[model samples]
Target: MASPAIHIPHGPARSAHLLQRTTAEWRERGEDLLLFAYGSLIWRPEFEYAEALPARVLGYHRALRMRSSVNRGSTHQPGLVLALLPGGSCRGLVYRVPRAIGEEALPQLWAREMPNGVYDPRWLHCDTPSGRLRALAFTLSRRSPNWTGPLHEPELLHIFRHAEGRYGTTLDYLLRTVQGLREHGIRDMELERQAHLAARHGLCAPP
Candidate 1:
């Protein structure tokens, strides 16, 4: 069954406050912080990292479930973005942020990822080649108003075709993410299928 349409609200101020409080606590403890990148972060981390490694998380999978209004689309013509939805599993990368720069880097990270508090920031266990590790991940809530629910391929193609946001076109975002995954030898079947569908419609991949 398809999930119903959602109306997303803007709340950057509230989101920022919550993130500030959370990150401050992390900094006071002086703990090593690791970040899990599943989608855009893979290609656009926009932060300095000490190291990154391929990792996998259980019990949750990546899905095109969030509606992007600022980065990949507008309010009137919303496009889809990836979210960590419940069920299955996901393979991505884990980034280690040096404790020395954690204070300065976290606020900047929050500003980029938590534009409207659409995602619920979480700490989840990921299995890396080195060992089991806990990393901060942005997860999506089904109850959130930003949830797009389950969308069909035609709907995905349509959204990818015409949606353009502050960052770039929706198609470009998808293409880059797929390319990024391939670079790490990770293959997300669903995203790959969607990319194939978009290509069938004659959408050119970004050079």
Candidate 2:
């Protein structure tokens, strides 16, 4: 399987443009919410938001920090998972919510995704094109064994390849994350290597 061509809706310049627009809207509306996306949420279309922007976080890394016990062969299912590992930097998208509606909107967002103990939401400082901002993001549960032990890329990919959810399969998640990384002008050599291995070994979904 060949690696998918990552589609960036607009060029890197547009990222700054979007940031300005989002910041202006937030200021005008007095919003107090920020969303940091590190996984499928970064590119999944169904999980759409009113204002989306390109953002980054320093001093943190992206990994398969979470695990799902509920397997989805090709559909959405409910259950819990584990949050594993730490160390490294992760790059993804961030969203801002208006202060007046943030509280009301966050619950809906949480309900849609974090129905069970599958995800642990936390506040992390994110670096954006505009500047630094605190955003809400989800990480895997710390209770799982994978959280404390060494993880192999192939194994994680295998797990994600079979996992399914309301939006799509785990392979879809991996593809979208790779695309999002390219869109944000972020690069991880490890991720690139893992992706290549997946492609070389025919680990991705069928085209």
Best by TM-score: 1
Alpha-carbon local distance difference test for all models: 0.82, 0.54
Off by over 4 Å in 2: 1-30, 45-50, 70-85, 141-148, 157-161, 205-207
Task: Give a tens-digit lDDT track for model 2, residues 105-174.
Answer: 6556654545433444456677777788777665543453325245576565665556675555555555
Question: Model 2 lDDT vs. the true structure?
Answer: 0.54
Tens digits of per-residue lDDT for model 1, 54-161: 999997899877898877889889877888987899999999989877777788888777787787777788999889988888888788878888788788878987
* Lowest lDDT 10-residue stretch of candidate 2: 1-10
